[model samples]
Target: METSTFVKEIAERFSVINRLHPTELLLPLLREIAKGSPVSRKTLATVLDWPADRVAAALDQVPSTEYDDDGNIVGYGLTLRETPHTFEIDGQRLYTWCALDVLIFPALLGRSAYVSSRCPTTGEEVSLTVAPDGLHRLEPASAVVSLVRPNASSDIRCSFCCHVHFFASAAAADDWVAQHEGA
Candidate 1:
């Protein structure tokens, strides 16, 4: 693909991914996680001064919530538990569901961030820094990010298998698209 065309497509995809967000009730919890501390359901309940059951019920309403075998909330929304998309800010280490989450979360948290993720096809590590302004120190400056929304019109939910991945090159991303259905 042409350089200009690829840049435009990436910008468009980032817009979509940026708009994908969790519900209002879960936003604070996510921000807390972004700060590097993993919040438990009980902690959230206590912090909000709400009953534990009520907090759990509210969490159930968000599709992004992922629980561990012990039923602890390990991830919610774009946040993951030590995944390939590592988002580091303020000495905190956290994970994101897709590459784009690394790109967008810094702005959401009102702080600068350093993000690292592997190219889905090549497994080459890509790293960059993001501030409210934009990206900087991006290794493989030509690298491209991939965003797939199974349902563009629907609400953002973890159940939806939308993907936000990274690729070292357009050809690499195209190769992945050919192998995956609906990519």
Candidate 2:
């Protein structure tokens, strides 16, 4: 077969490989590819229990690969770097890989309290006024924060991070705060 034909076949095979919805697996695959080695379609097909032609079809469909000016395939695939706007709250950062931290502050505050920052992490851009006190000031204040949120309706929760750590509505937080004033 001609060089161009061979390359085209490789591209097609790659497109088929993409059918695996291979996302998080990208890093490991890229690292292996970077070792100055070539990966065989057969190997991937065996691992995925897919036909080689299917793999090639998936790869050909993807525009993610790189090609030379002459339209020859050069490389394929990339690795995951980072997600946009990963959030941090109350000195702790939320991660996709782990279970979420329990929301303990609001229940502790009991009555209510007002937060200026929209929220601890989601950045939802909400404003809440709580009454009485979540925990009656049982915990000493070290750093007080205000509003922050990812977007609108964030007004319902932490304005910044957008985490619905608390279970009260804007009116609820307000009512609680108002009812237990000076407590």
Give the C-alpha miss distance for residue 105 in model 1, angstroms. Answer: 1.0
**RMSD in Å for model 1:** 4.8
Worst 10 residues of 1 by lDDT: 153-162
Q: For each candidate, give its TM-score against the true structure.
A: 0.74, 0.24
Clashes found in each candidate (C-alpha, N, C closer than 3 A): 0, 60
- Candidate 1 per-residue C-alpha lDDT over 1-32 given as tens digits, one digit per residue, 9 for 90 to 100: 56677567655654564455424555567676
Model 1 alpha-carbon drift over 4 Å, by segment: 1-22, 46-53, 68-70, 78-80, 152-162
User: Who wins the lDDT comparison?
Assistant: 1
- The TM-score that candidate 1 achieves is 0.74
Q: Residue 85 error for model 2, in Å?
A: 23
Candidate 2 regions exceeding 4 Å error are: 1-28, 66-74, 78-183
